[model samples]
Target: MSGCNKKKFPAAKDVVLLHQLDRGIFTPSISPFPLKLETYMRMAGISYENDFKNPMGPKGKTPWMTFNGNDYCDSQLCLELLASKFQKDFSSDLTAEERAIARSFQIMTEEHLYWVLVLWRWVYTKGKTLWDVQMNLPTGLRLVMPLAVRRIKAQASAQGLGRHSKDDVIEMGRKDLRAISDYLGTKPYFTGDKPTEMDCAMFGCLAQLVWSMQGSPYEEQMKGEFANLKEFCERMKEKFWPDWDQCLSPPRLNVS
Candidate 1:
């Protein structure tokens, strides 16, 4: 769990070495999948360290991990690995139907909502807002952002969401948000009063709107029309991320 160093590559016994982007002044990690994995680790009480160096894993994705002297990639697969190893089952108490619902919600957030957020951050905003808040980003990355934008645009187009207008994309995101809020209702967590694995994915995507994406229509809608969603984000933040501010670069002040 060393800070600002990758020389200590292999984590201590039973400690997870998470490879992901550097922290931001606004959020723990800019990418939701990384944030999702990190949140799952925290929720499961698994000891871990943050390795900003070599963020990309074998699968060429950020937020990969090294654990028990083994390397792992893909955030969802990483979650499964950690869950099996740690024996942490947040959804263990759920009914079969509830588990099915949780999986569906996770897919909706990660698959559908994630693309919309990406379009807004990387494509629509052109990574300006994202770059502005990132701490100590490399000069190379700044130079490569244009390529990254093109890649994302191409991916979005292939996914079919990019074919729609910006307004249509915003509406799609709103529908997803509304569905989540409706399901959440007054529950302290997504299902019942206790957090589950699905909550990690849910919070990962929702936290972006709460803190990272400034002036986004989705952000405004969540803050205004979807009071429950806002409350759920705040509740998850308070419960799991007590060091949320400290985790940020140049630690954000006056955070509510």
Candidate 2:
């Protein structure tokens, strides 16, 4: 959309859901899967809540990705593998398969990071952050978009989610790189021999997760823990735009 316009800021998760390939039922907490569903419906051009007890999609694309007329982005493992890829070193740690996942994740991360910068630019030059654009979000999805980061903190405290937080999302993302580095048993890619939708999904999810964890505990801990994720994030940054998060425009929203 015109080199990443903020028009989709309100639809970030929707964008993620639509183009996403597949989904798993009842994967894990309200996270990426719901994002995939929203993205899938949006991509297929459905943007409203279904009032019917059972409402089916337009009978094709969405149906294919759904179970009982519901879309799910089956990417839980992909996301986990992504963290592994980040935490592990690629030079001496990755098998051929892991390398494939790393490469695929880097490509996708680059694409999203470029747009993140664009959104930052637009937040100042054109529109408000989606946070300000509208206070409402759509429903009938898998994950919860979280009213705010405070809610995230509260959720963490309530669940005692063990070393994970709204912040560890990024650390988990950084740790994903370890997949490649730690994989002493496989070849390139987590699934072996090829880059699949899993690889691509991991890319976007991990990148955003790390991006979200900007100043969390895991972030400080990860500064040098996995040089691979940092280097890979940088490499992806350079691959798209050499100067990222530079002094272009002030941030409008704290995405975490």
User: How many clashing pairs per prediction, in order?
Assistant: 0, 40
> In model 1, where is the ten-residue run with the lowest total lDDT?
1-10
Q: Among these predicted structures, which one has the highest TM-score?
A: 1
lDDT of 1 by residue, 1-256 (tens): 2122243365689999999988977889878889999999999999998888778777667878888777878888999988988888888899999999989988998999999998998899888777556765666766789998899899999998988999999899989999998999989899989998888888888888888888888766776788888898888889999999889888434422
lDDT of 2 by residue, 84-125 (tens): 434422234456875676556555443333233223223222
> Largest lDDT belongs to which candidate?
1
Off by over 4 Å in 1: 1-8, 251-256
Model 2 TM-score (2 dp): 0.32
Every model: Cα RMSD to truth: 4.5, 14.4
Count clashing residue pairs in model 2: 40
